[model samples]
Target: MSRRKVGLWYRLAAALTRPPMMMLFRRDWRGRHHIPATGGFMVVVNHNSSLDPVAYGHYQYSTGRVPRFLAKSSLFTNGAVGAMLRRTGQIPVPRGTKDVRDALKAAVSAVNGGEGVVFYPEGTLTRDPDLWPMAGRTGAARVALRTRCPVIPVAQWGAHRVLPPYQKKPRIFPRTTHQVLAGPALDLSSYYGRAVTPALLGEVTDVFMGAITDLLAEIRGEPAPAIRQRTGREHPHGLPSVSGRS
Candidate 1:
């Protein structure tokens, strides 16, 4: 359970990205102690804005456990940005493809190798009009169950005020607060040693999503809605789901 050595590329990336993040948003990060101090783990997060990754990364990186994020495959095709991502050991997820075996294998291998892998299991940003967390895909659950690593449920809000989902412009003059809370690692002992099936994956994934939602509710100081939103489906408010290739 020794800490993974920080590579030069990660240091460089952090050096470049941290200052900008600090300038744009004030942070209210709690539960830092909940993050495994010395072990491989999975950090499951709810995605709202594009900037949350930077916010979450800064929070996690500040704790001295560098996380390898599962980012969009398109981001890996860019020139300089892509080079930095690859050099820093970020995983590229081929969104919407049935052929994610490679990415899944890489994630399992990373956790087994004692690296922290961050997963936005909802795949992409929540399509919920109320901005609550939506039902997620099973990628994180698969990795967690496969490695049985500590799965840290983290909830973050307030980034959307800086930059709304799918919007190109950021309202940066007035700095926003990035509120993130990391809950204790989820206990999946009952699921361990069980057969891995779609039903099992979905069940485990629900637990991950529920934990995240509860944390978010605490941050918002409001009760979460009774019904969770699912991507690609309409809900009671006549809100149509917006799909993303996360």
Candidate 2:
């Protein structure tokens, strides 16, 4: 099927699912209006739970952008859920591989084709007990730099409570509330058409993480976590590895 058709079907599915989901969450979702109506943009949010992508996808669809995601390839394996994901335009990246070049190309192309892509820089669900964002990978930054697309930092809170990581069942009894805050877009013009250095990439990644942390803190009515005092350096996760400039 064509990308347009896939997008249309996904939007319809979201419309049908959102009301019940929203009702289930009884979510007090706010700042959806802050999402850009038109343009190639990236929606960067913290990953807390498995339900997060669905919630964020619904929210982004409601905000007038059909979100295409970079999901783990494992989720796209042969299965009912995988079939559904295939139809919904979720691109899969193999876990723990340094070769997401195709996925990156697809993302950049989607944005250039005037679609929005939603990604989590943290790569995996938050390991933090508090569900605050951990250090982020540079995929989001790379995409933003390459496409020159606006990276809208989304701070999400409470989804973890709805369905905590590794829990087989969600708390569907008493409804839960989720908050999504859309921060201003990152400034990437400085690195436009130029290779992003390690220093530059780190700066951009930190900026995005800081914004998400601030948003989470705001929703939880608590202070953000203190920055690690280590000398700035890149850390490896199980996800694909890429150089700062690549």
Which candidate has the top score in TM-score?
1
Superposed model 1: Cα runs more than 4 Å off: 233-246
Per-candidate TM-score against the hidden true structure? 0.93, 0.85
Model 2 clash tally, residue pairs? 1
Tens-place lDDT digits, model 2, residues 166-242? 56587776677777888788776776766688877787788888888887887878886696222123323322111
In model 1, pairs of residues that clash are none
Q: Could you give candidate 1's per-residue lDDT for residues 29-70 as a string of tens digits?
A: 899999988879999999989888988999999999998999
lDDT of 2: 0.74
